[model samples]
Target chain A: MKPLLSVRGLSKRFGTRVACRDVDFDLWPGEVLGIVGESGSGKTTLLNCLAGRLTPETGSVTYNSAAYGTVDVHDLSEARRRLLSRTEWGFVNQDAREGLRMGVSAGANIGERLMAVGARHYGDIRRTASDWLDRVEIERGRLDDRPTTYSGGMRQRLQIARNLVSEPRLVFMDEPTGGLDVSVQARILDLLRSLVGSLHLSAVLVTHDLGVARLLTHRLMVMQGGAVVEDGLTDQVLDDPQHAYTQMLVASILPV
Target chain B: MMDTISSSSSGPKEHDGPVLKVAGLTKSFIVHAHGDLALPVLRNVALAVSPGECLALVGPSGAGKSTLLRSLYGNYRADAGSIRVHHDHAWAELVGAEPRTVLDVRRRTMGFVSQFLRVIPRVATVDVVAEPLLRLGADPAEARDRAEFLLALLNIPQHLWQLPPATFSGGEQQRVNIARSLIVDYPILLLDEPTASLDAGNRDRVVELIGQRRDAGSALVGIFHDVGVRELLANRVFEVSP
Candidate 1:
């Protein structure tokens, strides 16, 4: 099958600092690919480039959009890119505040995505928002409250609801379980796992945590410095890492 | 107290038939705005959960799945029924148990994970997760250490542990709520949509954690909408009708 997303010769740089170099990959429909690396290893840069958040200095990201067919994400017009971002794609930030509108009511934050997709009826939007809240495990009673009043976990859940409310086919998640408590991360991981399966979402998950990759991802790409050092099936790579860097990464995980 | 009927000396062994038993459990709500209209949420519900068993409640919305779970946890009082929980070597009736008995049961025998996390403003995330152990008279350091472990397992960053959960995200708060409940190994566990907000990775961890608890002999009553998790943990399913 033709991949849902294709990245070729992807590279990015900031002045003299090279962020990503010669990264190449293909993500199939309904496949979850994890980009794992240490800090400043270009995983985030590569993700940003693919998600169209950062314009790569070289290479191309071609997405097979349901609405627009196959198109280059970086070459699209600004208006069309915005539309794609709001409709076919979702980006979940590590920090909830970075992704969520703190001043808006939780209901509005979720409804806004639906509205962007041309859903205009107030009752329908409100009902959808309420349903999303329930899915994210937020109390429907807190629908009218601003996210600023929410706890960190609540805000993250709200963020997930807001992003997934429109049912985007492809999502970009950066350390989705990054900063929460252990038990909290477990619950969120469980929810994410279910959502991914039910939604059939193809995702690019960027994380430093190997455990996160092992549980959520089907394929893995280990990055060191600014390039892909190893890439293969998640279990195979984690179980028997071929690259020295991948070996080090796997060995570094503290045994539970 | 009826609880004294089966003191440790005379009570059934730990591997006895069922740790929890419910018979003819029924509940209804009166809506004054509708001229005292009676809304029957649950009726004639009967269930028995043995040690190491997980009984999942599955049904359509408003089918009273959550109501049944809450009733088991004594959050909602049943109008007519008996909720017999095997604790302190005896079966205590939860339906009309004294307030003190209910509180005592909650503290020592039951652990509930509600759908929404009730955040206590200004309480550090670590302390919030640790409070359950602390209440059980565990060493303060040990309690905090356990709290930290669960928090880390759930992916809560170490830096955020000292900060209050008030500023945390919804998922973050729910994690804390889960951590708090799981910290104490109560004999009976009641969970309401426990993995509803979690992501794919964390969800698997929760399934394993719940599996461990069930394997360790905790009788679990849960409303599991996630079929994957329900299948993984539930030994029997009780379907609630709308």
Candidate 2:
């Protein structure tokens, strides 16, 4: 089958500091790939490049868009790129507040995404928003409340409902569960696990937690100092790590 | 004889005293606008869960399976029944226990995994998972470390440890819920569609974890919609008819 997204010679740098170097990979449909590395590693940079949020210094990121056909993400016109991000792609931010419109009601936030996808009926949009809220475990009665009034977890769930309202084909999540209490993290992970399966979503998840990589991803990529150090199936990489960095990463997890 | 041997080997035998018992458990709801209709959800439901055994609840939708599970967890009050749970080496009636006693039992003896994850906004995922351990008087650092291990096992990425799970996908959120409930070794576990949203691979992982817990002597009561998982985990089956 044709790969859903492909990256070749992908490199990104900030001034003299290299964020990612010579990273190459292919993401198939319905696959969850995890990018694992410590802070300052190029995982986030590579994710940003792949998601078209940051321009790469060299190489190309290509996605097989059902609407636009195979296209270079970076080379697409700004309007078209925005359309793709709004329609075919989703970006889940680490800080939910950053991704959500804090000023608007949660219902409106979710409705906005539906409207962007050409949904015009007010009643239908509201009902959809309400449904999404329930799916994410938020009470339907709180639909009219602003995100500012939502608890940290509620805000994050609202952000997810907003992004997924349009049914994007691929999602880019940067620490989607970051900064939550352990109990809360577990719940979110459970939610994400189910959503990914039912939706058949292809996602590039950037996380430093090896456990997350093991549980959610089919494949894994280990990044260090802005380079792809190792890549393989999730179990193979985790159980019998080939690269020294990957070994250390695996060893660092506290035994359950 | 062969069937008896295999069944006994696979699951706890009935000779062993049950960890949880219910008798004549009935619940009803009043329909406000339907001329004061009393909608009876559960009728004389009786069941027992032995240590190291899993009792699977099988029934169609609207059969009150979830309501039965919640009543077992003390989340709902049974209208007419004695719900007894073994704790502190004695059986205590949960039907009308004091709130403090119920809370104590929940904290130390019973663990529940509900269908929906209740996310407390602004708390980090690690802390959320670690709360049970903290309540059990574990060291803060130890609790956090254990929580990380469980989170990783459930496939929650590390970066999200410090963030709230509210923004996570349905699957990710569900994994978090599993990790939290499974973190502490409660004597009795109540699971409601635990693997409803998990992929095959993750679902297997959860089954493995549950098996481990059962082997460690935890009695389990669960509602498994997935027939395969239900067959794999449940040694005893209880069918609830609507």
Candidate 3:
């Protein structure tokens, strides 16, 4: 079967700087793909291209999705692209603030997405938001408080719940664990692993942490400069790195 | 009664205690416009920061994280609590400090970065970054020099420094927000979701900058949603529960 998401020779540039070059990949359902790289390695640039945040300089992103089948994401009309962003695709940022409106309460943040996709009944939206907050391990009483009051870990989880509440087919996470503590990072990783597996949702995670990549990704892609230097099963890449950069990265990580 | 703050910017003396202290803090709004007697937003929340420590606060959404941070900086008045800050290097209560003292503490000793970048709609980025310094009585030339240095350190594009941050990307706006915070040599820094709109790389950069600030002897209280960020940046962590 064709993969759910297919990218063919995708490329993006910011004036003289090439953010991504000739990127090609296939993301299947029920799999987490990790993209790891240093700053300016273009890992995030690729994710944005796939998420429809940035238009590609070349090539195409084809989505064989359950709701909208076999269409070029880049070629979709603005309205269709918005529909894709709203209903089928969920993009989680490294910063929870970006993922939510700080002015609104936690319930509203989760419900806004639902409302965007034609969920009008106020009671239903509130109920769904409450359910998601509970699912993400947030207490019920604080649903009316703005996100600014939540801690970093809680905010990130809230962002995750907000995106997942709509049951998006695929979610994009950018450094979801980049700024957390060891204990908190572990819990979040465990939560993400379980959620991704149990829900059978696909994810594209961008991170510089090998531990995070290992915990969540089935396949790992090592990006250098502006291109994918290596791609293989996560265990294979970590256990026996092929590329020099990947080897260096694996060596830098503490052995379990 | 909440502690009272002194009204001057004299150099430090030995009798002063921790820069900020809050105990048994609680706050709520009536929400008269929406409904009468709405629920309280914060309850029995207690936390503190010394002269040079970055305390990271962690909680799920609606846990009163921002309220806790804002109340400390004197933005929101606590309904039933006390916040004592030894401003002016002398012992004093910060709760309901005089306007001059409040302004003094905010201008010279406290720097706040909100989640949204609310730069003057038409102001130049350089001017925005230097505003805090100017308000603190730094010479215009010195303020401009400091702003330029900080912006360069944060890797903000030179040409864009003069352009309104409204035109910048989320990541760029966040950088400017950070620069604005540091423009004044405030002893304490309050950041509410400082990296909320950035990508992996930009988020890391923002974290790095905050780490540097903490190292340079600035006390920090930051509210963040990303666990990775909190772990990397904070030496101490506090979890808030409803």
The sequence of per-residue lDDT tens digits that candidate 2 reaches over residues A168-246 is 9999999888898776777677778768866879999999888777767777889999999977666556764656677
lDDT of 1 at A22: 93
Off by over 4 Å in 3: B1-242
Candidate whose TM-score is highest: 2
Candidate ranking (DockQ, best to worst): 2, 1, 3
Task: Estimate, for each residue in A1-256, the C-alpha lDDT of model 3 and write its tens digit.
Answer: 6788899999999999999999998887766899998999999999999988899989999998676679998888999888888788888898989988999999999998898778999999999999888888899887999999999999999999888888888999999977888777766786787578557788899999987887778778899999999876675567546567876787788754
Positional deviation of residue B6's Cα in model 1 after best superposition, in angstroms: 43
* Stretches of model 2 off by over 4 angstroms after superposition: B1-242
lDDT values for all models: 0.83, 0.83, 0.79
Candidate 3 lDDT by residue in tens digits, B1-242: 21122212332223333677777788875443344445587787777777557898888888878878877776665677777766666545666454335555776677898877764445579988887766556677877877887777677989888887878877788889888886665677888999898888778777877776676566788887888998887888888775
Q: Please write out the lDDT profile of model 1 over residues A1-256, one tens digit for every residue.
A: 6789999999899998999999888888878899999999999989989989899999999999999999999999989999999998999999999999888899899999999899999999999999888998889999999999998888888889999999998999999989998877866776787588668788999999988887778778999989999876675567646566776777788975
Pairing residues by index, what is the TM-score of model 1? 0.53
Predicted structure 2, TM vs. truth: 0.54
Q: Is candidate 1 or candidate 3 better by DockQ?
A: 1
- Give each prediction's DockQ, rounded to 2 decimals: 0.01, 0.02, 0.01
